[model samples]
Target chain A: MEEKLVSLPEAIRAHVSDGDCVVLGACLEAAIPFAATYEIIRQGKRGLDVAAPISDTSSDLLIGAGCVGQVTGAWVGNVSSGLGHNYRRAVEHGEPHALKIRDHSNLSFGMALLAAAYGMPYAPVRTLLGSDILTSNPEFRLAENPFSNGGEKTVLVPPLAPDVTILCVQRADVFGNCHFWGSSGVAAEAALAATSVVLLADEVVPPEVIASDPSRVLVPGYRVSAVCHVPAACHPAPMTGRWQRDSAFFDDYHKRTRERGGFLAWLDEWVLGLEDHDAYRTKLGASLEDLRIKGEALSAPANYAAH
Target chain B: MADYSTQELMIVAAAREIRDGEVIFVGMRLPIAAFGVARLTHAPNAVGLFECGIARYEPSAETLYTMADPANQLGAAWATGLLPMMTQLPAGRVDAGFIGGAEIDRFGNINTSYIGDFKAPKVKLPGSGGAADIAASAKRLLAIMNHEKRRLVERVGYITSPGFLDGGDGREKAGLVRGGPAAVITDRAILRPLGDSRELHLTSVHPGHSVEEIREHTGWALKTAPRVDETPPPSPAELDALHRVDHEGHWR
Candidate 1:
């Protein structure tokens, strides 16, 4: 009963339901779950309310493939590669599909997710006190801090308990104990906050291997509902200790998806066109191998002889 | 005479502005590049706090790998989550941080969200990442951007980062005290808060740029510092380090 093994498509099909407020655990470039995101697109999931504190690949691709209906994000740029062409076209021009946006500073958005993790009604953040993000969004209200020396206006952000939070982790066990290195961004907060978790891991080690070094364990097995083994889960985005961010891939993606027709074409060949992540990786082949490397792990892994 | 791109001049100027042994909260791209150069050249002990939550990170300006990623981020003092580092900004722990926007006004408030209106037409920019938090929390906020008339406007379409709010006592009224935008280092000139107000006044002009041109580019009635200093060209040492860091010509 403790063992939770599922395919990427099975995980998406099992966990991600229609109209779910799906949260993605990502940063500018680290631990971005691009493979899981493509599955959501291939499964033809629709009307998804996508959420991320700061997005680059995960949210952009979902929105591009017409899987997302609304995008609640902080910053939506394709770092180093410039603006996200799909994101720009959606919000600015509403080309392939019209997108609804609720903006927050990356901090405030994390604050909201943190509130849900703590099981609190709202989280009080100080950084958004003077920014227009508070002014523009009516949901973010300035409440008088009762503890404030009388005049301080603190913005009370509501909790964001997403129905699902899909994350890319460095390693996980069959029992779903996930470990991550480098920057977790808001993933730690979002994972605890979400109602369900779909974990996409680069390498699935034995439970003993995950237990060997407990310090690396971020998400406990109990919190994770499904653990799918997906190698190179963070394509384009860098996996800590394993590979560097594929800046060239981002450059090519930006150039290819500049126009609506071209973007749809990319979706055809990459996401919808491919049967699954393995197929997608097969197409990438040698170039994908070039990006692979051995990350600095805490201990010698269980060596399950993964595919 | 040396050939340096306008970006290099600003990077050197920004690095020079950063004092030794200070915690600088830097964002992606240009700010990170400037901090990297600063670490290699002058501020060796200077800690670079990234939005991704690496505290006191020292990046190799030459490799210029993505600082947000820890694998690429070398010589960081501590590897922590965003929670503690993010809270540090509001606690007034950081000495200075870098910020930029589509538009910045005399009051110093910036807009990086929308160009025309909030809910309407025109360009919709990628909203606040950590710039708003950095601006609100840093003890001394350094605003760096390319100098253009459209960018330097009378009033930003929206205030994504609070500079001084309205002017004098505006930031204080909003419960912001310790850190607000102190200076703007751009390609054309260096601007500082005027007198008691947060209004930007040209403190110095770059080697090639003229004060008149700077004023003409500014959206408001730009004032000049009593003794405007001509920004010296980037030293050979600084230029050499900068070029090595930004070998790809991203911010060269």
Candidate 2:
């Protein structure tokens, strides 16, 4: 089989299909490989299901951009700050379906995916047993009331095997063996549970180097269908890379998003106007320089000492 | 005691209880504000830890940036970087924790996950981030939230943190309490655990809030302190400090 290396969008387009369930692993703003998500959005495929441990800017952006048809996760805060108007409109107006899992239940989503990856019928979860979550959601039910006279009070969550898992990491090899120094377990589990995996990395290093660090290797190349080398891909946001967050852009976006009209206008200027992350950075122009200074100031020693 | 505005009051009251130089884990949103206020004012040496791994962060006087911000690493007097800080939190090194909730039962069980249903929820919220570990491991737990019937329920829809477990010697049975939720601060009043029942009782009501106001919102029985004292209002200086830390006024 010929191995493929391409940009994030190409890698995603090569694998993603309509009605495919997807899992993503990223922090609030740093996780989702925007390049891939943008491709998914541009494709405008429906019947897509997404499961993330936590939803951040990328997840919200995808939903807002009309890419995700169904979402299951813990919370949607910090994704464009408290569920963007698009997500709210979709869920409230019944345009798209959304299933909001409770915190306890949210943990189970990850556990269940882990179980599925391991080929289990269902994962035994301790979350949301006594609460109304069990009684309310038919998807979750009491396997046996462990509280009952020596019985097991196991809450059974069905397996969640996504069709594709998309993750962005700090570094990877040409063969797709990846390494993330920070929290990689969440994304790793999502990748294992999914049918296929696509990795977008900040840099493409030699496979031998990744192999040498047995402990740091998060995802093996065998599981990955494709690898895309995209530096500073998580733009207008922070990523674990050489580049820092474009704070000025974020502040502007934050301010504009609070106002409904201004948000739509800002989205147009940023999301619609930009062809890619590079374009977005270009449009900001002087503001990006200002942000660099602010970023440095915010990260400076004097500031730390003052606090 | 400082004269605190609503925002400053929340921070000061919460901060006063936190000792200096303690490792306090903080959840996102309001708790972040309270932690910032506490760090900038009372507990200067106290470390502010986020679930995402920022530790002992010295945030700018203005703006509590995202927990993941690299700026979170700027103020660390020590060499512990973001990755190390993230590791320590789950390993249970944090001393105190500040959390907010959508609902809190008598047992101190908190729910910030969902409202309405689970499989299909009316509203989805940010799930617990290191809440379970913080609740389980922290020597002290302090909760700050607005008192409302919907929030101060008899039973939470979900138990994100094990609050007094099954009650009585139950926490001991479940092995959940090294130290657990010591106090709960709300807009209306403050509450503490009563006896071994794990139930919370009112210790004091803020000025202008009556006992009935507290009781009306409480799903469980509301107990009164031996001598209830009004919480001091935030002074202008404290308010300015708080606003300076959180310029967006989202903390308010």
Candidate 3:
């Protein structure tokens, strides 16, 4: 097998390209791969079509930085502070450029991604029926359910196969066997559906450890194109067992990105000026240490006694 | 009875909607806090199904910032991704769903997409997050929002979630299989779809608030229940449970 391990910059440089349909594998939840996202912005990737089933500051930052040409998602916002200021500006005002949006419900979009993962043409769903979501996106088709007797119908959601998916997980091996534990949100499906995957690990462990608990592997090593060892990869967003959601930082982000000038300054100070996650951590100082997981509520070990 | 804000009363009212042993697809904001209150108080056996695919049999140790918050996964019955729980909606596994919106019409059609034109929006609200899916298929839908003219409008600019749609079997005609807009729980009153027209009517008003005030705030010609019932104030026990659920007073 080929060595998949690479630095964060190398991973973004090699796998992610300009005009690529990128899936930021976080669904308004923990383990948002912001380190990789910052690198994508720093590298000046352009015309990128970003897909986040349920987004947050990650998508907004990309849009604000002028990297994103379009966004396909259910929701995009700061979650805590308020709406994504950059997103609102981009869509309503079109300050940077006109952003093409393909709105989808979390379930509908997830089903589309699931269909892609399963190598299916499309997934049929019963939802999105009397809503304008059907009218907004021409790709979604309402088809008669041939299986049902009472003239029932199903909405066929097109498969979403992105060029590359960036997944930030709790741990991964050099071989890119990713292990994640938390409230999950289509990370596994996104990885499988993408043509290639870039795995970002906060703590890169030995292959032996991943093999010991194979059930924990969300995405297998073979599907991964590159693995980047970047601790605090999901900073500001909790990485489950490692850290907590930095709501104060998010609040600052929300405030700073209210205007274009403040937003660019935020990008410069946070992404451009900072060399890497380490420098960003240094700038954050001791406060980052305080956000570490305080108490233990460990899951019971699953016994696998096979000789 | 303890002195509680209308927000607290609303939360309690929303909590009371949850049956003791039903699967609910809980949306963000007030619904999350309401579920917490429900689990901690009356509906201990209720199961909360988040859009992110978390089946929470018990309330989180702390209040949730988002439905997909890590706190939600703690002690969860099951933690999968969107597909599993979302699949439950069509399979008839969900009993009721809680949805919120920026604008909602008398027919209960919700708009969270945009405020103005579809192509060029004056304000582009956060697009439908699982509200549409839940609204379409959940056996019963409960809409929780503030009682304001802009919110309770004559017609929403966009239908992000299907309610009665145009009313009078419109949802069924559009291929929606399940129930639509069971009730609308606002800060001032509880509205339910009445008659075959399915237009929302004022069923019960919270104490200290009159039918006139509710009608004044409503964007449409609000119909009143012949005998309007005053919503019961939050019990001391309910308030205590709510405080513990939202210790930080984030939602309150």
Clashes of each: 1, 12, 0
Task: Find the 10 residues in a row with the least total lDDT in model 3 chain A.
Answer: A23-32
Best by lDDT: 3
Per-residue lDDT of candidate 1, residues B1-252 (tens digit): 648878888888888878889988877667777887888798888887877767655664344345566444545666656777778887878899898777888888888888887776377777788888888888998998778998999888798888988888888888776787778998899999887876788998998779889989998899887889998998888888787778777764
Q: For candidate 3, lDDT tens digit of each residue in B1-252?
A: 437888888888999999899899887777877888898888989998887778987778775666666677778899877788788998899999998889999999999888898789998887887888889889999998889998999999899999999999999899987789998999899999999999999999999899999999999999987778999998888898889988887745
Q: For all the candidates, what are their Cα RMSDs to the real structure?
A: 3.5, 6.8, 1.5
| lDDT score for residue A150 of model 1 | 72
TM-score of each: 0.94, 0.73, 0.97
How far off is residue A184 in model 3, in Å? 1.7
TM-score of chain A of each: 0.93, 0.81, 0.97
CAPRI docking class of candidate 1 = medium
Q: What TM value does model 1 have?
A: 0.94
Best by DockQ: 3
- The two-chain DockQ for each candidate, comma-separated, is 0.64, 0.22, 0.76
Error of 3 at B101 (Å): 0.9
